[model samples]
Target chain A: MIRLERKFASLKENSKKALVAYLVAGDPDISTTLELMHQFVLSGVDIIELGVPFTDPIAEGPIIQAAHDRALQANTSLDMIFSLVEEFRSKDSETPVILMGYINTFLANSKALESIHERGTDAVLIVDVPGESSLEDIGIQNKNIASISLISPTTDNDRIQKICMSSSGFIYYVTLRGVTGASNLNEDEIQKNILNIRNSTNLPVLAGFGIKTASDARALSQISDGVVIGSVLVEMIQELSEKKDYKKIYNYLNEISAAINP
Target chain B: MDNLRDLPNSDGFFGNYGGKFVPETLMFALKELEDTYDQLKSDPDFLKQIDQDLCHFVGRPSPLYFADRLTKHYDGPNIWLKREDLNHTGAHKINNTVGQILLAKAMGKKRIIAETGAGQHGVATATVAARLGLECHIYMGAADVQRQSLNVYRIKLLGAEVHAVDSGTATLKDALNEAMRDWVTNIDDTYYIIGSVTGPHPYPMIVRDFNSIVGRELRDQSIEHFNAFPEAIIACVGGGSNAMGIFYPFVSDPEVQLIGVEAAGSGIETGKHAAPLNDGHPGILHGAKSYLMQDENGQVIDTHSVSAGLDYPGVGPEHSNLKDSGRAIYLAVNDKEALDAFHMVTRLEGIMPALETAHAFAALDHLSGKFNKKDNIVINVSGRGDKDINTVATMDGISLD
Candidate 1:
């Protein structure tokens, strides 16, 4: 089993909800991202979602898009990100690292899957590639990293079943129809969808997209396995980086962690 | 070619290219569109309606005129112009828009959304939506909206709402991103009319089927005029709608050569051009696996061209497949070459061609004496030059009042 499954199993045993924190790999610079990864784990982040910055992140709103641009401007590439993951893995191997980005980045690298495993990545979530396409179809599934799939509110029951069966890592449920950083999350609708997905698979379903506040994460954790925070964390990284204040990031994540953990 | 026509193979892939590389929220919408198009394509009544609209509404069989002056200038092969520029709305865009609007109406969609680069497709879609009495929204990049102000006004004048996208290079790709977000939000009632032969499966197929009338007409017109098929067919390829339209019917004809011209702004060596097939590698962008202008990290690079319509980082997946299979030849024409062709065609033929189409005409200089005297070469004049008049004048250091 991949590190994601192991982490989730442990979380279930401890009766704790997973606190996932997302950070763009090369935001501002690679060293900052490296420091933030260690800081994220230190602040009780159960899962670290590392975003490989892409030029066209259609699913993201302005905040994350700007983050990606900043990362790209810093000359962050997949190889650089993999090296960061390798460095991070040398110190802390317990936290699961999931590399999330558009499909083209992965496809561009010939040994992407092998390098992913070599760098000690636990999982990968390609935002643009739907469930209809499998990692095996692209000739890269045996690298031991879990290929995660997304389940959205617009996903029909039949597709939900298909995606759940094919999905290896935790299923990411988009809480809203809009892109990342969009508002208007409905707890009831998310709960119903999570229930529908849970019926199809034993894998954990984590709600993401538009989960801003601790209350929002707390409300979502009541109905689902966990809540994955993205835009809010990414925004905080941008703000804190400008002030050269890394303590605020740690403090902010600690607050979110405490809210979800309790 | 007979078997090639039955491609995408239920998985929406065209030979390792062209798959549904979109968010999960849009999968149902794509599947719905595929099912609807599959059912409607074979319906005789629906086919007849589309045919009638092509003939009466959009003016089908846009002439295959012999470019006497251009041929004399080339002094090599006899040249012919497939006059798609004469279509209603002044471009080949109306052909695809008319078909998609009919499809949207048949599917009971109440609203239409589209993304535009130079605003040609936006105007075409808005015109059709207005004709069909449906709510229309067009997403155009803020930069494009500024560059193509006339087309922006044209879209608004057709009673469609224009959303200026201000993210990610502020160009066609960004506009497409915004459109996709809107479709995901309002998939139930809104139908997205993709401008070109790119995007997720069924979309490429649907757009190709709708626009293939250009090649079908060329096949008949060629026989009538020259008593044989033209030795070569050329069209500009930005996302490859016009090129695909002219190349599809000729795919099986081994004797007829299909050439796609791509924009090379400044030059391909400068790393500032939109010639994906020439300078790019195979990668996925804009929902399809195709040759894209991207960096080593797979991030799509910003593309440049004198024509706003051709300034896209990716080409249609079918074009990529064709390029790989050696069935079609792809070439690049720099800004200077294309601009020269644009002026030459206008002066010689007395017909102003769109900047995108000028790329096709520019390829003639590259061919120089390659064809026999009797060999005929047909170029698809994909659009009129009116939208580009101001841009051209400004480039020529002349103020257009």
Candidate 2:
């Protein structure tokens, strides 16, 4: 089984929800990202979604966009991300790592994409290339790397199925109606959307976007198989990376993990 | 060869250049737009309404004047000006905005949002939105707001809210990003009126169709006046709306040459210009894959131009496709040449051109002696210089105060 499937299977068997942590690689610096990747898993992160910074990340809100800008300013490239993943893989081989970014960054750099599977990257979630588009559509042919698709609250029944038809790993259900880090999550709407998505695909649905606080994660985990924490954690990284306060970051993740699992 | 007008191939791919590369949240909205446009494109009533608006409201059939002195000064082909600057908003941008605002009303959208570079599009969008009694919002870069204060005040006077975007080089691209974010957040009642022949599928197609009135008028005027199609048609391309407008009708005609002038701020070699077709590679930005100026790391780089309108890092995707398929020729002109052309046109033709339009005028130097004296050449005078006079004065070390 792929690392994502195996990890989900293990989480299901243990009756625990998956906690996915996302961070922009090389935000403060490369070495810090490498250190945080390992720290994320230790704090009960089931999967790691490393942001390959692009010049334009339209899907992101200001918090994560700033993180991407900082990461790009630090000279982070796909090659650097691959090495970061490889370094993380050397210490921890069980956790799944997904590279999340825009289409141009992946398609324009074929050398980086062609070797992502070999470099321990398990999946790719391109924010822009969604709904009936696969990696193959863009001439990317690495079958080993699953292409994750996002389904938003605005997605209708027909599009949900179409998006799922081309998706793997899991379906990312954007809990809110806006970009990443946007606020105001109506649990009723999120639950209804996730249920509609579940009707279409057997693949695990991971709720993300606008999700903040342990209570939010725990509440969402009840409706979905897992939860992906992005902007809030990215905000924390931006605030604490310079101080090297890994424990504060790890503790925050641990609180969310414990909240969702318990 | 195979009908350039029939391009984008239903999926919005202008030969792998334009596509719906936006987030999944926007897919439904795009489909809704595409479906509505597909239904109304052939509707006679819709067509008639657009024509009436263009004729009465926008003051259409903007005169194609013979630039006698400019033609004599250049000592080349007979020069004609397709005067888009005479439109209601003082530029060709109003043509697309008028069409889009009608569509927004047709779709029952209550709020209209747009992004602007030089603030021309913002003012244009505001003008239409006010006429239609819709809530209007315009996102402009902080830098652009400072540079184009006249248009900024004009947009506000038209009762539109101006959101100054301060992120990502604080320019046009950043304004576009902020506008998209606003649209995403308010998707239900909001209709985003994209200002260029850029963005996802239907936008490029729709904007081109609306603005193609320029080319259609030129075709009729050419036969009535010059007795044949002009030897060459030239327009400045920023996001490529005005150029695409005038070039679309002539794209399939082999007799006419279509030339697009891009801004070469400092120069292409200095890695500061906005001429993506000349020095950049194919990449995706602002919801479409096109020729983009970016670093080797794939991060989009900042572009430079004295004209705020042409200082974007990416061109329209169709321009990229046209450049590749050899249907249209693209040339770059530096700031100095554009300034020279601006001054020359102001003095010789008694018509001051926008800095963006000046780039198209500057490109004429490259094509000098290429055509016979009797052969006609048309340049799209896309906008007036009223908004750019301050920039020109600043560059020349003059204070209006």
Question: Each prediction's DockQ?
Answer: 0.79, 0.76
Top candidate when judged by TM-score against the true structure: 2
TM-score of chain A of 1: 0.97
Which whole-number lDDT from 0 to 100 does residue A251 have in model 1?
85
Q: Which digits, one per residue and each the tens of the lDDT, describe model 2 over residues A79-185?
A: 88888988888988889999999888887677667778888999999988866788888878788899998998889898898889998899988887788999879
Q: After superposition, how far is residue B75 of candidate 1 from its true place, in Å?
A: 2.2
- Models 1 onward score TM values of 0.97, 0.99
List residue ranges in candidate 1 displaced over 4 A. Answer: none
User: How many residue pairs clash in model 1?
Assistant: 0
Off by over 4 Å in 2: none
Model 2: how far is B248 from its true place, Å? 0.5
| iRMS of each prediction | 1.0, 1.0
Provide the RMSD of all predictions against the true structure, rounded to 1 decimal: 1.7, 1.0
lDDT of 1 at A246: 84
